[model samples]
Target: MSDASLHNVTHENEAQFGDYFALLKPRVMTLVVFTAFVGLLAAPVSVHPFVGFTAILFIALGGGASGALNMWYDADIDAVMRRTKKRPIPAGKVTADEAKAFGIALSGISVVMLGLATNWYAAGLLAFTIFFYVVIYTMWLKRWTPQNIVIGGAAGAFPPMIGWLAATGSMSIEAVLMFTLIFMWTPPHFWALALFMRNDYDDAEVPMLTVTHGRRATRNHILGYTVLLAVLAIATGFTSIGGIFYLTVAIVLNAQFLWGAIKIWRRDEDASEVDNFVVERKFFKLSLLYLFAHFGAILLEAGLTRYGIEVL
Candidate 1:
C-alpha cells in the first residue's frame, strides 16, 4: 500500500501504551543501555549507585527519543519496507506529528535530567547523539548516499562514550575504543541484513549498500570492514580496558566473525538463494553476539580489576 493509504487506514482500536513504547525501538535501546552501562562501569572513577542508575536511565531516554524521531521522519519509507511496515507510524497506530512531539519532549527531558543527574558534558554528548541520529543520519544521510551507514554509524557509537563521560566527566582511550568498536561494527552488521532482506531497500528507495553497490560489492565491503573491525577489536585488548578475559573474547569472536565474512565473500547469490541466505543470516545473528560478548568481557574485566583480581 502507498504511504498515504497506509496513514489513512481506519484503525479499529486506539494505540495502546505498548504501541507508544514501540516507537522507542526497545531492541535498539537495549544496545544503547548495555554499552552505556559498560562504559559507565568500566571508567576509572566510581559513581553513587542512585546517580549511576539515573544517568543510565536518562541516556536510554535520550536514545529512545532519537528512535521516535527517526520513525517520525522515516514513516514513509517504513510503510514501503516489509521489515518496518508494522511500526507505530507506518501501522497507523501513531501519527507522525505525535511521534515528533513525543521525541522532542523526551529529548528535552532526558538531556535536562541527565545534566541535573550527572554533568552537562555527558548531557551535551547525549543531546548531540540525539541530534546526530535524528537530524544527521535519519534526515540527511539515510536516503542520500550508500555511505550513509558508514558515516551515520557514529551516532550509535556515542552511547558508551556518553556513559564514560557521565562517570569521569571526560573522555579516555578506553571510551574512544568503545566508540570505534560500534562504529566499525555497524556497517557490516547492517549490510549483512541488507543482503538477506534483499529487496526491502530497493522497494523503500533507501540507498543501502546492497541496493547501490550490488551484492558482490556489498560482500566485498563486509569482508573489508570485518578485517578492520577485527584489528580494532583485538587492539583494544592491549589498552587499559584490555585484560586476559577481554583479549580471549576478542580473539575468539573476531576469528569467527572474520571466517563468516570470508564465507560471505566467497558465496554467490545462487548459493544464497539455494539456502535462503543462510550464511548471511548466520553472520547477522553472530554479529549481535559478537558485540555483546566483547562488551561483556570488558565489563567482567572491570569487575575483576575492582577487587584487585589481576586479569593480565
Candidate 2:
C-alpha cells in the first residue's frame, strides 16, 4: 500500500482490548523485560522487592510506549512488509492517531512513575530510550540508512542500564558490561533474520542491510559482527558480574554462534534457497537463545554470590 492509502485505512471491526495490547509488541517486550530484570538483580546493591517491582513495571511501560509509537510512525512501510502486515495499525485494527495518543500518554506515565518509584537517573534513561527508538531509529535511521540497526540498536541496549540504575541509583562497569553484551549482539541477531526475510524489507523500501547491499554483503556483515559479538560476550565473562557459570555459558554459546555465522557466510543465495535458508534460520534461532542464555547465566551467577557460593 502507498503511504497515502495506508493513512486512509479504516477498520470495519471495532478495536478490541487485545488489539490494543498487541500494539505493545509483547514478544519484543519480553526480551526487554528479561534483560532489564537480569540487570537489576546483578547490581551490587539490593533493592526492596516492591521498589524493584515498581521499577521494572514502569520500565516495561516505557518499552511498550516505544513499540506503540514505532508502529504508528512505521505503519506505512509496515503495511507492505509481510512480517509486519498483521500489526495492529497495518491490519487496520487501530488507527495511527489512536496509537500516537496511546504512546504519548504511556510514555509520560512511565517516565513520571519510574522517577517517583526509583531514581530520576533511571527514569531519564527510560525516557531517552523511548525517544531514541521512536524518533531516532523508527523515524529517521530506518528509512535513511542501511546502518539503521547498527546505530539504532542502542535503544534496545539501554534497558539493562536502566535496571542497574534502579537498583543502585548509579551506574557501574558491571552495568556497562551488561549493556555492551546486548549492544554487540543486536546486529548479527537482526541481520540473520534479514537474510531470510530480505524480500519483506525490499518490498517495504526499508534500508536494511540485506535490502541495500544484497545477501552476500549481508552475510559478510553478519560474520563480521558475530566475530565482534563473540569477543564482547566472552570478555564480559571476566567482569565483576561474571562467574564460572556465565563464563562457561558464554564460551559455549559463542562457539555455537560463530559456527552458525560461518555456515551462513559460506552459503550463496542459490544454495540458501535450495536448502530453504536453514543455516540462516538456525543462526537466527540460536541468536535468540544466545542472548537469553547469557543473561540467565548472569542472573545465576548473582544468585550464587548471594549464597556465598561464588564461582570464580
Candidate 3:
C-alpha cells in the first residue's frame, strides 16, 4: 500500500481535536454514561461521591474506547453508508491507526483505573464489554449475520451491570434485571431503524435483518420482540430496582411502544413506501424514549427508596 493510504498523521487531511472526539462516538457514549450512572445510583448500597464519580468517568472512557475501535474496524462499511459516511475516519479527518491506538490505550487505562477505584468485578465487566463490542460485535457479527444486533446487543447491555457492580462490588438480581431490560430492547429498537434505512444496509452489504428477511419479516420480528419486552419490563417492576413510579412508567411506555409496533406490523410495504415509513420513523423515535424513561424511572425509585419512601 502507498504511504498516503497508510493513515499517515502528516497527511494533508490533518485531524482536528473535534475529529478525534467524534471518533469516540459521543452520542452513543451519552447513553452509556447515563444508563451506567443510573445503575450505580440504583444499587442497594451507597457509594462515596468521589468514588462514584471516578467509576462513572472510567466507565465512560471504556465506552468511548469501544466506539473508537468500532469505527476503526467498520470504517469500510461506514464509508459506504450515507448515514455514516461523515464519521471521522471515512470523512478523512482521523486515521484508522490513530483510532485503534487511542482505543487500546483508553481501554487499558479505563479498565485498570476502574478496578483501582471500584472493584475487579466492575472492571472485568467493563473490559469484556469493550472487547465484545470491538471484537464480537464490530468485527465478527456485524458483517457476517442478520442477527448481529440481537447478539451484539449484549455489549450495550453490560454498562448498567458494570455500574451496579461498581457501587456494590458484587452482582445482584436487580443488576441482572437491568441488563436484561436493555438486552431485550435492543433488537426492536435497531430493527425499527433498519426498516427505514434498509437500503443503506443493503447498499453496504451488512446483512441486517431487514436486508435478509424483508420488511414483512422484520416488522413481525419487531412486534414479537416488543411483546416479549413488555413482559420483561413489567416484570422488572417487582424487582428491588422497581418501584410504583417505575411500574407506572413501564406500563405507559410499553403500551406506547407496543402500539407503535402494531402499527408497523400492520402496514403494507407499498403503503409504507408511499407514506415514507412515517410509522417506522415514529416507532424509532419512541424506542429512544422508551429506554430512557424506563431507566430514569428506576433512578427515581432508587432516590425515593433512599429517603425511606416505600416504592413497589
Candidate 4:
C-alpha cells in the first residue's frame, strides 16, 4: 500500500483502540464500580474474592459501554457542548460510526460475559441499563422534555442493583433501597451541574433544565429534588443493611445538603451576585462526595458486620 493508505490504516487501528476505552467511559465507570462493590459487600451473601472482582469489572465495563453508546449517538450535541466537545468522537479521535460499533460490541460482550460469570438476571439488568441509558436517556428524553434528568436519573442508578443480583442472583428490598439512594440522588446532583453549566447546554441546544425551564425554574426544581433526595437518604438508613455509621452519615450529609438546597432555593437568580453560582457549585461538588461517602458507609457497615461487630 501507498504511504497515505498505510497511514490511514494505522490511524484507524489506533482510533479503534481509543474508541474501545472511550466506550468504557472511565470516570462514570469508577462510580459504577464503586457502588457495585458497596452493594456486593452489603449483601447478606458473599462471593469469592476473584469472582467479586470479575463481577465488578464486568459491571464497570457495561457502564462504560452505555456511556460510549451515549456519546456515539449524541456526538452532534457533544461537538457543540464545551464540556463534551473534547470527547473521543467529537474531538476527531474516533468517528461516530467507530464509536457506535465499539459501544455495541462491548455492550454485547459485557452483558453475555456477566451472565456466564454470574447469572442471567444480572446480565439482563446490565442489558436494560445499557438500553435505558443509550436509547431512553440519550436518544429520547434528552431533547424531548425539561424533565429529562428527573426521568433519565434511572439510568445512573442501576449499578448497585446489578451488584446485588450478582451476589444473590436475585433482587431484595435492601438492594432496591440501594438502587433508590442513587436513583433519587441523580436529579439533584445533575441539576446542580446543570445550574452552573447552563452555557454549555445553551450552546449545544441540549434541552437541559437550566436552558429549557429557565435558571429560576431549574433552581426550584433542584431544591424540590433535593428535598426528595434528603427524604430518601434518611429513610434508607432505617432499612435492613444500614447501620449506625450509615445512618449517622446519612443524617449529617443530608442536613448539609438540605442547607445547600435551601440556599439555592432562596437565592434570587436574577441577582448578579456570584453567590448563586458559588452555593450551587459547592452543593454540586458536595453531591459527589455525598454519594461516595454514603456508599462508603454502607461498605463500612458490611465490613463491621462481617467481623462479628454490629453498628445497629
* Best prediction by TM-score: 1
Query: How far is 185's C-alpha from truth in model 2 (Å)?
Result: 0.9
What is candidate 4's lDDT per residue for 25-53, written digit by digit as tens?
A: 88898999999998888888879998889
Name the top lDDT candidate.
1
What tens digits encode model 2's per-residue C-alpha lDDT throughout 160-255?
999999998888999998888888889999999998886898888888989888889989999999999899888988887888899899999999
Global Cα RMSD, each model: 3.8, 4.1, 2.6, 2.1
Residue-wise C-alpha lDDT for candidate 1, range 1-312, written one tens digit per residue? 799988876666478899999999999999999999999999998999999999999999999999999999999999999999999998888999999999999999999999999999999999999999999999999999999999999999999999999999998889999999999999999999999999999999999988898999999999999999999999999998888999999999999999999999999999999999999999999999999999999999999888789734
What is the C-alpha local distance difference test score of candidate 1? 0.95
Candidate 2 Cα lDDT to native = 0.91
Q: Clash totals for all models, in order?
A: 0, 0, 1, 1
Q: Candidate 2 clash total?
A: 0
Off by over 4 Å in 1: 1-11
Provide the TM-score for each candidate, comma-separated.
0.96, 0.95, 0.95, 0.94
Runs in model 4 deviating more than 4 A are 1-4, 8-19, 270-276
Candidate 2 is scored at a TM of 0.95
User: What is the full ranking by lDDT, best candidate first?
Assistant: 1, 3, 2, 4
How high a TM-score does candidate 3 get?
A: 0.95
Quantify all predictions' global Cα lDDT against the true fold: 0.95, 0.91, 0.93, 0.86
